[model samples]
Target: MIKFGLLWHKISLYASLLWHKISFCGIKFGLKLNISLLWKIWDYCNQATFNEVVYHQRTISSFLKVVFKEVDSNFAKLGTTNNSWFDYLILRRIGVETRAAPPPSMIEVHWWPPVGPWMKVNTDGSALGAPGSIAAGRVYRDHRGWVRGCFHFKRGLGFAFETELLAVIYVITIAHHKDWRHLWLEADLAYVVRLLNSHSLDIPWRFLASWKWTLRLLQDLRLQVSHIYREGNNVADLMVNRDCSEGWWPYALDEIKHAVALDMSTYSIIRIKY
Candidate 1:
């Protein structure tokens, strides 16, 4: 009985070494193993070393089954050849071939509607090469998500942040001129949102003119300014990249209409399972 127990310990140790080698190989090629399973295997090996259980072919087979069951089937297929014992074991259990699960798709959150029946404007700006050439854009949508107006400008030379803040300034001025009292302004840039939200006057000297004017317009209106993710600001994004310097308003431009339609459709929620 003592000799059999000693031989079982050696076999378990050898099996552990093999698992370590195979797991390492899989990891080297970007395969992620089930960590909980790895821990269980480690614990079982440690217990086998300390326990007085006698060796048996059934016990060894059962141990292999437990370890293999924990492995990712797809990765297992990648690591072993058709003739490999692991492959043979998998084939016997599942029959035919079992493909790995597809990778999880990314979760995309799109434009959320504004609160209540208030007009909302989504604004964005782009600098072709940071400071090379600048363009600013804004898209207006009423409570029902109808395109009220849209505008774009070829503002000659400026930084990206400058263009972003300037775009908000233009939108607010337009809103004020039209006496659109209840307004919501949304932009993708965090700094631009912060400046408007805090009503800050401390801005770059060049932007001071537009900044002060925007504040004056804000004084009389029921206004709200917030930041949105870039994905949700697609219509404004399209306007900035368009060839026209102005008048994409009423969404008459076919390309702009198509983009807006697509953006509106993507507002639905998507759920992804791994």
Candidate 2:
């Protein structure tokens, strides 16, 4: 008996929503008659069940398209003088309204010393079908101690060192796109950082090739690459973890990482070793 009652309630609610959409369409299109009757129907529709509302999604979408066409036609006929029609109907649809005026304003100010530019890159890698993983993050800060950017990468493949090199490649690609002239690259991977800085001889030739390629692109710009501690690169670390766990596309992951790097590089220059 209770289930039957619930079913009946759902049916009634669906009927009300349907009626409301019809009435709203009619009124909006300037079907000028019995406005009070339509208002009552509209009120009842607003009070209907949530499930009924979801069920009417298709109907509502169609109704909106029709109403938009009507509005466009009205605008064409009336020109800019018909602004009030849009203000009244669209605002009501979204339930926004202006009411009270604001009081006289009070001003507050805070200031800090300007920081210079630096680009921090962090990277991590995770291997497929294996528990082994490697990750790295770097921060580049300007002379003023403001962080320019952060980068993180994860490699689950056994090629942790190669993944580190890839992260640098990603960073350089971002720098090239943004037209950065001078950048300080920091990473937590000592061997990779030393390789980039030309201070180590034991690193792989592939990594050397990537570094050379990055340098070729940055030949017009001033570039410095350094090493920092893993803990100092937490933000990039988090980003890498999120990407790995969520299985984000390489393009999307690069986009987000590059955006962070660019924003940081443009604003502040602070570098910290983790």
Candidate 3:
């Protein structure tokens, strides 16, 4: 009797292992089917025994069977689905992988208008006292609608208004390089814009000395500076924030890199008129 009991125990262990193998096969088949691997699964199922098939159904086999049937039925109904078999497989794998994977790191990309005739310039500045760091950003867009380029500058700890003034200086320097005329410069800082348009450079005069040079440069090229709301200046703000980080300079003006990295399609480009 003891021998018989031992034999029964061994059989049970073997049965469990067999069941596990069959279940694994079924899961593999189901996953493949999601990716249009129906033929491969069909071939596998054909060679499987009734017991093995039944075992597969007992262990998450019902779930896989439902998935298989749903996918098969959908494919049959669609008749001419747009996706290729490889694409289907990749999408399915992505979905599964996404669920099992950690959340992806967020990447922020700024949008700037196109450059052409009669372009508008937008600029922004950021300063942090603790880090003693200051950064400025500027963007140029033409009337014909294309982003000419963006410029960013970082200086050691300075006043917030100083950073804003630096941004204007940077924009003027860019205009000089491109020989852009009839420019309309816009910034979110009201006081800075007022100071730029002010007749007398008051207490800010010391800081305004270098700005006089930039002002003379602007006068030589016929540039007009204006003040805009912060909300309207999001693009320049994005550039300034991103420039605060390391390694953002290389791809700063690369529209292609921005498009590819964001997974934006040609259609979006057309829609945005970029």
Q: Give the backbone clash total of model 1.
A: 0
Which candidate model has the greater lDDT, 1 or 3?
Answer: 1
* Top model number, TM-score: 1
Q: Give the Cα lDDT of each candidate.
A: 0.69, 0.48, 0.54
* 138: Cα error in model 2, Å: 7.4
lDDT score, candidate 3: 0.54
Best-matching candidate per lDDT: 1
146-217, model 1: which lDDT tens digit per residue?
Answer: 788888888787789988878888888888987788899988898988888889887889889878988998
Candidate 3: residue pairs that collide: 114-145, 114-146, 114-147, 115-142, 115-146, 115-147, 116-142, 132-157
- Tens digit of per-residue lDDT, candidate 3, span 230-256: 655666776777634422232236532
What ranges in model 2 sit over 4 Å off? 1-114, 123-156, 199-202, 205-209, 243-274
Q: TM-scores of the models, in the given order?
A: 0.58, 0.38, 0.46
